[model samples]
Target: MQQSKGRPRTAGAGQESSAERLDGHGREPTEDAGHLRYDDPWYDALASGWGESAGAGEPVPAVVAAARREDESRGAAADVYLEVQRSAAFQEVRRRYRRFVVPACVAFFAWYVGYVVAATTAPELMARPVAGAVNVAMAAGLGQFATTFLLTWAYARHARLRRDRAALELRWDTQELTRGVDGGAS
Candidate 1:
């Protein structure tokens, strides 16, 4: 319903009529009538950005779609970042290494100490080397080092894989969110 200056303001029949109404000629209303409610000018004024145009039912430009997609990719990246932060796989890998690595090392040292004591206390066993110059203590120590190295390597690999998976998930989610926004805006 368009209101105009000097027009009599009356309520519909059966509704109480107003004794006085503010006709559309308020100083500001006269100055901006073209941009009044229900007009394109008003909508344009409210729409200040590219997203606003999309909100106004305007066909978004291709560049806008691409930009939205990029934004979505970033959001996806953020999601992956969060998932990695929450992932049990990543936590478990770290936990396992902490729980077992030190204990294994301690056990190795204990075994070496025991072997050393046995060798010093019993020369018969020490004299009989398992392989030229390499007796039981040397063999056990070398084996312990090998096991430690392998465990460290395995834990590192597992942690790396978990991080990568989390990153990939975030990337995809960001892309999808952007795409959804683009479609709605367009």
Candidate 2:
């Protein structure tokens, strides 16, 4: 890295390089922006430096020791999750989820594609007036939006009514198994 005589000096050991700090649009990242979404399920807090660093890196020998320990712990944790996943309770919950989701997704896709096919292939039918200046195309287009909301509501309602309790119980069971407090805490 060649230092340009005219370039501004940046202090290390305190902050990342200004070039690295800039966002995709060449603008600096805003501190006030809400980056973490508590409501979101897909947020990766560990990878995002939310709480702390990956420990045991200060000493050279401890890093090697920690690496061995980490590998063992990871394998054991993986096995526990794999075991829980293969359990009948987990399978039942998954089955219930799939039972509702698969059919609902298929039906919704069919409905949407059917509408598109009707609009494109059968223009005369779509153009047929339902009421004063309100054609079948308009009605069907509106039906698409209606069905979207209907399906969303139905999915949520079904999950809450049928699967939520069983899924919650399954989650609790998995958590308890993973806690491993009896001299086996990983």
Top candidate on TM-score is 2
C-alpha root-mean-square deviation, candidate 2:
11.0
C-alpha RMSD by candidate, in order? 21.9, 11.0
Q: Weakest 10 consecutive residues, lDDT, candidate 2?
A: 53-62
Where does model 2 exceed 4 Å of error?
1-64, 181-186
Per-candidate TM vs. native? 0.30, 0.63
Give a tens-digit lDDT track for model 2, residues 1-186.
Answer: 212332333555355554534322112346665442222233223332222222422211112444556567667667778988898988887898899999999998999999999999999999999999999999999999999999999989988998889888877776776667323563
Which residue pairs collide in model 2, if any?
A: none
Q: After superposition, how far is residue 162 of candidate 1 from its true place, in Å?
A: 6.3
Which tens-of-lDDT digit does each residue in 29-57 have in candidate 1?
33344644211212222223321221233
After superposition, candidate 1 runs with Cα above 4 Å error: 1-94, 161-186
| lDDT values for all models | 0.52, 0.65
Using lDDT, give the best candidate's number: 2
Q: Which ten residues in a row have the lowest lDDT in candidate 1?
A: 19-28
Clashing pairs in 1: 72-174, 72-175, 72-178, 73-174, 73-175, 76-170, 76-173, 76-174, 77-170, 80-170
- Predicted structure 2: lDDT: 0.65
